[model samples]
Target: MAELFARDTLSSQRWRRRLVPNQSFTLGRSTQKYPVVWDKQISSQHAQLNWNGVQLEIRKIEEAANPIFFGSRPRISFMLDPGQHFVIGHTEFLLENSEPTMPLPHRSPRTEVTIRPEEIRRTSFRKTPGRIELLTELVSKMTASTDHDQLITIALQQLLHGIPHATDVQLLEQSLDGDTKTFSPIAWDSRDGVSTPGGSSQSLIENATTSHMCVLHVWPNEPDPATADFTQIAGHDWAMCIPLEIKLNQVAALYISGKRARLEGNLTEVEILQDDIKFAELVGSTFANLSRNMALERRQSQLNQFFTPGLLDHVSTDIESYLAPREAGLMVLFCDLRGFSAATEDNIDRLIPHLHQTSETLSIITSAILAQQGVIGDFHGDAVMGFWGWPVSASENPLGGIQAAWEIVQTLAGTEFLCSDTPAKAGIGIAAGQAVAGMIGSRDQVKVTAFGPPVNLASRIEGMTKPLGIPLLLDDHAVTQLQSHPSMPPNTFLRLGSFRLSGLRQETQIFTVNSGEIAWLPEFSQALILFEEGDWPQAISILQSLPTQFGPRNLLLQYMQGFQNQCPASWSGTIERNTK
Candidate 1:
């Protein structure tokens, strides 16, 4: 029978489907047909495979998002001869001529026990000089491999090489979820060219896993054909399964089988010696530790997107201590590109370049936050939200957010990121207060973010930057915190004035920093004080006296003129904003 054998290169999973002569089959992610789940790279209708009486013909269909790779080059259509294979996404599909057979059950192990490292005496294990050299070479290969799949493949190959009589060696991942247990093939190598060697004894594997030990089973020579357990060890005489401890939920095992006839000697049922078993156990232990380290490194790489090296090191030691949700003091910062929308709209023909430009701009903001040891919360299009003091108290560096904001302004000023173009501008807002901060979301998805009035106030202050004619603003709390902190630089913090933020009841005093070109700061401060005190005449006089280049003074002059040169009766020294 003709069949299509599929293997997931990363997961070490195998799936096969019998191909009928002159019949068409679809291979992709569509539920109505042959569905390839979990891989998004494959389109719903990725390709079509047709197996005629002579050979198999595979063609890349139009719906495939990614190309079908034949070796390194992509092929739109190709004839798959016997033993030919092609790759789509992470799955490799091959055409085979052999008829698939069900795996035969294996006999129970006569002796299974957890092997103690100290119990394995050196006197009991003996190896030739050539065998020792082979083991050394295999160990070097395993140590150099960083990927789990590659490591498993190397371990299997090395095990097969070390045990010359072994017919096949397989690496299997055994996982327990709730009451169900699963055994999946990770990698396998055979003395022959077979990709997946069959006739593995389940009873032996189960015994090794249950006891977390090494199981050795030797079938009797010339055994009775009527016994049901006889067929379990049909092809091989003796087999050994060494359990590799990876984790509490997931355990792996190394299964090695050998046919006594391959030894070319008059041997009994037990040809697998203590030396061979000991070597397999050693390789299994090395694979287990390396696999665990690889998984941790991959997870740490993902976490690096949100945390700094220092914070991530702490997080790695005790995740529950930092990730648990709780109320704590922190500083939150909100940063946004000033004219992103207009810039994107104006360059609609070159939107991709503009998007790349936006990403580059956002990278600057992210780098500044991480440099200050702040955690990135979320990104909203052109805006980025970051916070400090969760997992760790912000009492040590309450001015981190402030410092980051200042750094962003200073960094953006030197580049074309904020050129003469209106859309190239940026705005930032910072606030410090107590809030519930930690991982927030469902079981499927979660994010570390702060939720409280201070968070809202920070966003409101960011919005106020445009209307107030300033590039950056901070709430009064941030200013107070910065005042107490001795780490502040020589930059001037100008008081913008008090205003009622949208959706916030209490008025928040706004302040902006003189990071650049704020000429006539004293005049602007004088005008703001007079305007807040309802001294319209003197305030207008001082505001007019200041340079028109001062945005705050110009904005104030416009506000006073709108009231016909008189303070309104309802005015309470606070500007009321209707929107954020």
Candidate 2:
């Protein structure tokens, strides 16, 4: 074997190449074909060198404008001898014969040095050039990868390049469940681009558990009972398997096969050349860590999906902090499907589909609420409660809730009903005030919820929607906040008369938005203003003149007509609710 030491002047970098007998290698700027391509003033196919066993021949392939020099003289072809110099552009090379020669004797008595067997082994291992570089390149590739399967594939490719005799490489991952054990191939590579021992080689995998490292001297040609199936499957003369200890009682094996017999010291030579065992261990540990991290990330994502985004961030940072109770100003929203019960009554065939549609509608509603930074609190039979300002505060909770409610109403309006004759519809109520929010319930079954007047008022208002024939309603506090909010326009809401809610003493002012394009809103608002100002006759006249669609369903109109025959002496327009 002969060696060429190429040195660069500008970068002060050096590269070494071994010249094999009767074989040619190129040096040029094309890295795909040339082994020693560099950023120099050289042609893509600059030169080629062929070693004919004893002597070395160099031929210039490209006619360079600048002369190619051999010992400071321009030459197109020359036979390189030991210690000969050649130059191509700014790069220089020196030829050196690596033939073994006898050691020269010293004139004086030199101290006899003894090398231990381990030291000799270590020295031999280090002398194998590119071993460290190969390991570094493999590690770089592994670290840069995020996917576990891709990492294993990269490892197989690197192994094929690092181990010269390795004709095929396969990684087998072992999985254990109770008394059952299974091995599956994760990645593999072969010189002929066809995987050996493929997926059908289960018997070979079963045998891998018997030993940490297994070597087959005569693989396919002389098959033994222990490895006959594998030998036939792989069709190789020699093979080795190294087990990587990933965890306790769990291992993944790296298998390498070749169609060549092992000469004396061949196994040790292979070990010294590439350190295959260490590489296998690295592959196992890297993959194990990556798998663990991926599982953790998946679990985190699953947990995050269960909470509102604002609450999820807090939950991820600290569970206790997120669960801790705190007083906050909030806007609570309650929404319930109107005809869900009737849609699924006494109909088991339609029950599942109805439930699916309900779930989908709930998902759409929750998405709208969450989009406005609201946290979903609880779910009843056909209702869902959501609130803003718990884990984090919104700039304007009332406006946010109203916007979310509007979006919900719009979404349901366009949604096709799955189990109903009519399009699906829902009633939503929003109330804004101070509330206590936190995780509540037993240790085994905890729930994040809000408590106080705002939450209760929102629920009551939602119940009122069924009788009032309104899709969305808001309380006095929410309307006031929305009016004062910087982002909300003043005319967003139409004020309804004040009413005493069921089970509540104070009269709560109610309001509703023009969810659809209702042409009677201006007249309705004038009637409400007249009713509030004690002009019952004028209010009754405006109410009677309005469309009948706005009469029976309108709570205020119903109250006014009930008192039309005999008006109260001091009516304050406060309609009291008898039931929730």
Candidate 3:
């Protein structure tokens, strides 16, 4: 085995890693084997190295953006023997043939005893009034406490009251790097309520961890020469360390210490028993469980920003299987606020308040989607994109996107904003089809979103809302899905005609939810069918009978009048849009 030392001269930071004889490791900015996040110049997978017991073999990756320099010149490949060094960016790496060593045992003289969990008698603590009160208070406080530090404090205070022999209590966290171990005190207190530092024994702490049991160290009146050099704290005559079960790659322990009997201070000697150890173990177990739960909650809260509760629950069960990138059927929805540009321009003097209004309105859009168990894919300015049928197929609710769009339209109609002149209105577009959905991006950053035709079509349909004078629009596929859905109402879908959305090769048939709002929809639909069939004279007669003020009716009349009320040579009825 060999040790690889990485030192950043700029920050004076150092890290050591053990190298196995035959295994290879890569060093780069984003490589999981060895990441150098501090330096932006180092490319991903910059170099690969392998230690062969005799020497270290290094190879520069062709795709690396930076050069690996040895001595003063750049090298594409090289061999490094023991005691040689190389530099990459601002970091310097050294290869050494020395095996990592553990810290030496303490030099002080003391006696010690170790006890495994099963060796104890498992007796309960004394049922004194003070101990009973302390135990009751600890259980009540731990149940109600949400903060990690507060719970630690409550346990420590209770321990001090229950154990009369304990003079100091500490919650210690151990961090490991290679063969090195570092212990830091999280919360500590003495019987007098004032903390004194450096009363913990490193060797005893190690013993407790290695044996996964409690360790007690005490100095007898006459120490045996053979065991006199056993490690212990210098000031405290006795100490107990109990290991805690915590997160992987992390170590924690509960440490308690007190002084021995002395002639001058009249401090009586109290024998430590299984009762004290059992009580300490109980507190440690509760603390560990609570800490784990709190950590899970924090992660869930962060995940909620992107995933709905149902999706989150599925991911929680099998994250790798659910989040793996795959092709899936998706219903994509794109909702964008109307007249936002003009509204922003109108509130140039009160930009802050206008921004608040924009955020609130966007929240309404996102909430409606999430309420229907949809995933928020992305956001662009005042627009928000959401999708359904991912992780679990939308087979259960194929009309989720349409349902959410209707809710958004109903909610935003009454929302008042700082820019009162511009009404709070939004254009919604929905499309259902095949798309690649799941977590996508490099290891450094990732986004959960869907990609393919449906996403683009949804965005294009949303843009059409403004030109077609409709608040909501859906692609033909979405309407087809809703037609067979049991929850949808009959005769609610009205065709808006086919369109060649900008950049799309296939013509998309657009439709809107009628809801009987437009009284002339029946006559308008009649004209639209005739117009699409190139029967311009018949379509014009129906259009002329309808109210001219209706936005869709007027728009259709203008299109035919553009070619002198006669069907042109290219009369496909597919309106070709030049812009999105």
**Among these predicted structures, which one has the highest lDDT?**
3
Report clash pairs, candidate 3: 389-394
Error of 1 at 46 (Å): 19
Local distance difference test values of all predictions, in order: 0.74, 0.65, 0.75
Q: Name the top TM-score candidate.
A: 1
After the best TM-score superposition of candidate 1, give how far the Cα of residue 235 lies from its true spot, in angstroms: 3.2
RMSD of 2: 20.6
Which of the two, 2 or 3, has more lDDT? 3
Give per-model TM-scores: 0.73, 0.48, 0.60
Give one digit per residue, the lDDT tens place, for model 1 in 81-170.
Answer: 888889888888888776312224654544443455445424354445466676687768767765565566667767777787787787
lDDT (tens digit, per residue) of candidate 2 on 1-580: 5666566666534444556788887767653323334445777777778878666788888654455789789889899886787988887777766432111111111111222223333443423466578777776866665545445656666666666666777666677677876666545566644323332233333444454433223233555555344334445544445555442334777666565534344455444323443444445455555555655666566445445555565565455576687898989999998787787785667788888888898888888887877877888888999988877775634466887888887777432211123333898989989999877777687677888999999999988776666667899888887788777655877776688999889899888774445677788788877877778778878787766544222566677678763458777768779999
Candidate 2: where are CA atoms >4 Å away? 1-303, 306-316, 396-398, 414-424, 515-520, 551-553
Please report how far candidate 3 places residue 22 from its true position, in Å.
Answer: 46
- Residues 321-404 of candidate 3 have per-residue lDDT tens digits of 678889988999999998789999999999999999999999999999998889899888989999998877898667778878
lDDT value, residue 385 of candidate 2: 92
